[model samples]
Target chain A: MLTLAGVGKRYRRRSVLAALDLALARGEIVGLLGPNGSGKTTTLRIAAGYAWPDSGEVRLAGEVFDPDQATLRARIGYLPERVPLYDPFTVGEYLDFVAAARGLHGPSRASAVARVIAAFELDAVRTRVIGRLSKGFRQRIGLAQALVGEPDVLLLDEPTNGLDPFQILEARRMIRAAARGRGVIFSTHILQEVAALCTRVVYLHEGRLVELAVDGRDAGLEVRLARASLDAVRARVHALDPAIELRSAEALGEDRHRLVFDLGRAGVARAELVRLLAEFADLESVGEATPDIEQALNAALAAQARGAAA
Target chain B: MRGFVTLFARELRHYFVTPIACVVIAVFWAASGFFFSFNALFVAAPDMVSAFHNMSLLLMLMMPLVTMRTLAEERSGDTLELLLTLPVGEAAIVAAKYLALLVILVLMLAGSTLAVIPLALYGTPDYGPILGGYLGVFLLGAAFAAVGLAASSCAANQVVAAVLTWALLLLMWFVDYAAALDGAGGAVRWLQHVSFSVQYLDLIRGVLTRGAVVWFGSVIAVGMVVATQVLRARRA
Candidate 1:
């Protein structure tokens, strides 16, 4: 398990991460969804104890709070975005190095390396240099290294970034297997991957926490976020504006549900709808209306350009 | 400590698995062999100090090649993140790398000692200066490797690391050139204090002065700390 509390980071004059909080528990595979520069990688880096945050602390397994402690970092396995590797070392050698570096020695180290090689299905290319492998194999090897030490927490940045569909499937399978007894949190831009693999999803926007949703049914959105209950949110919304009509409501789960409004009967303004949803459900993003990340980024960039011209 | 040794082993493996280490060792052996045969090893003074000095200079040239990729390649290749995020401290990472470079230097230095074989067979080779020269060159190699490690820590790539290391070593070579200048002052004294070759020459003269030992020791210590700080800066 891992928890990041009030974590923030700034590079020079640019604020890369605002006050953010995230908690991931064992057996939970959460996907951090965000566009580029959304502080997803920074957050993950801080959680992995690779980067020290300007203001905040990361606690692993609830008790080990100091990121400066080297031994505490052993409980974490991180796969950076680029999947940095020594090209000349073979797959087995690299994994063995990582295992030993994590404090595994002798028979234990060898078995750990062998286990990851088999788990990632890297036995075929175990003897080949990493540089000679294809991109997919390279990604798998990176994953294997992260899985080498069998750490309790896994921090992966864009594990499926450049992989093909088959490779992505294999990666997902590996990630799921890794999460069986550990806390798994990976960042990605793909929506379907989150829907298919994550039991929970956190959305970050402009370096701030935007939404946190739970996929309880393994079908629809079921999450407890905003650190509040659905009934508490509904009561707040009712207090704000009682006349807001709710045509239909469906309870997807105790914490997550769907509410439909009459759009034609009375033109509901976006502001009121947002307020109702914000107060009715502890969700930063509502209605599953986010177009793919590419389109959203384009629109934001276009707006920025227009603003610059003005 | 296990992390350091583990990382050290991996670094040694990296040096050999790539062609760089082999090329450096082979080049050193060939060049030393050529010099011992043609540079009048026995015609000059009885000792092989000059040959040893030349070997020291050769190490100055080859150390940057061995150490350039120690941290620079890690940064460029993104492996530093993977390594740093493990249960290893920044100091440990730097020490492991510098230790690996020292091991490589030992291998090459050991190979170069073969030149003394024919000297013993053909001439009355005094073992005193030879032993002293080996110690001198080995210490000199450590200083060069440390500087190379510091340079590698700051460089963006291996090529840049190599260039910067060469420049640093060259500066150390020439900084104390004016130790005997007419207006000898703070700068000259400073250079004399820091000059790597100055400290190394004492060991070649068969005298292990405290100043010489401290000079090489400081370089090894300060250079490693600088390298560790460079890596630690990333966290900030």
Candidate 2:
């Protein structure tokens, strides 16, 4: 199991991640969903041991994940957002070096490199320099590099970013196959990919982790299935946070009033808004906040994270 | 460690598989040969002291180009991210790269060292100064390569890396001459002690002093340590 307890990170006065708590066990595929500048990359960077969190800690199998310890670091295979690879190196040569650096030696190193090459279907272009390969082949080569040592955990950042539809399907399949016995945390904007691949999801808004209900609940959507006071709920929301104004209240009769939150103008924390919604007991079945709204809310969230950091 | 050795071997392959290492070596040998032949033919004594000075000066300028891409290219290409994520210390990465460039420098100098055989063949050249001069040249190359590696890490691309490295090496080489303008005995001695060219003068004189060897070795160590720090800081 891998765990991040109260992990936080800041870039100058801007907090990129704040008080994140999460865990991953083997055979679980978790999707990290976030808008741009929401600290998804920072979270992955900290998790990958490439950067240290400003606060809290990460544990790998009950031990603190020390960056100084090669054995601990060897247990992780990371594919950064940029597809970090030497363009001039052949796929075979690159994987060979990755395997050796991951602590696989001699015959084991050769076998490990071979295993990933075959698994990622890189054998055909193993001799080809990465600079000359197509985007799909390059992406596959990046995957092969990460899978070389058969690590216990995988951290992938937008694995299917620039791939064609066919290549995207191939990459999705590869992620499924690769996560068979290892814990996988992948970040992607494609909700369909999350629905298709992730067993659970974590959302980041302005570098803060939004702890959505883990009992099969999405962060941004719910349908009204109960009768409760709409006016009382509106009063409570305003009282809890003055700037918040309930956008619309529709009467469903028999003491039921459907409340639709205008979160875009509210600039309220998701947790606070969810808490206000929970009080009504009439609201239920809300879908995700929606990625389309991601841009409109980016500034608000960024301002919020920066204000909190300050 | 396996990580260090792996990185080192990879860098060496990068040097040879491309035309980079061959071009650098050819140009280096041509330049050194031109300077040596000119000095040997034109000088009254036909000794290699001036030739060695010319070669060291040539190497001072060329070594950064040899090392400029070592780290800067990795950063620009996004490979540094992959390397840092590996289960290896920053020091290992720095050491492996610096050693690889230094080894290439030493190997290139071996070709120049062979020029001494011809110098000995044509005239009554003292073999002691030639041996000391070669040793000095090797040390000088390694030191400059280290400086270049440090500069590469600080740069965003290879051109900036090469320019920064040149600026740094030139400063170290000329600081003693700059100090001479001060005309104070104690300051002059101290500046000479710190100057790379002044340190090289001992070997050029066939003195082979321990202090100069230690000074060059320290420069290599300090330069590499600075490079390692730069690499580690980038992770944040």
Q: TM-score for all predictions?
A: 0.83, 0.84
Q: Candidate 1 regions off by >4 Å?
A: A64-67, A214-310, B41-46, B178-183
Q: What TM-scores result for chain A when each predicted structure is judged separately against the true chain A?
A: 0.72, 0.72
How much of the real interface does each model capture, measured as fnat? Answer: 0.94, 0.83
Which residue pairs clash in candidate 2? A220-A287, A221-A285, A221-A286, A221-A287, A222-A284, A222-A285, A222-A286, A222-A287, A223-A284, A223-A285
List the global CA lDDT of all models: 0.79, 0.80
Stretches of candidate 2 off by over 4 Å are A213-310, B42-45, B182-185
Query: Which candidate gets the maximum lDDT versus the true structure?
Result: 2
When summed lDDT is taken over every stretch of 10 residues in candidate 2 chain A, the lowest stretch is A213-222
lDDT of 2 by residue, B22-119 (tens): 88888888888877777767865556787778888888878988999999998998888888889888899998998889788877777777677786
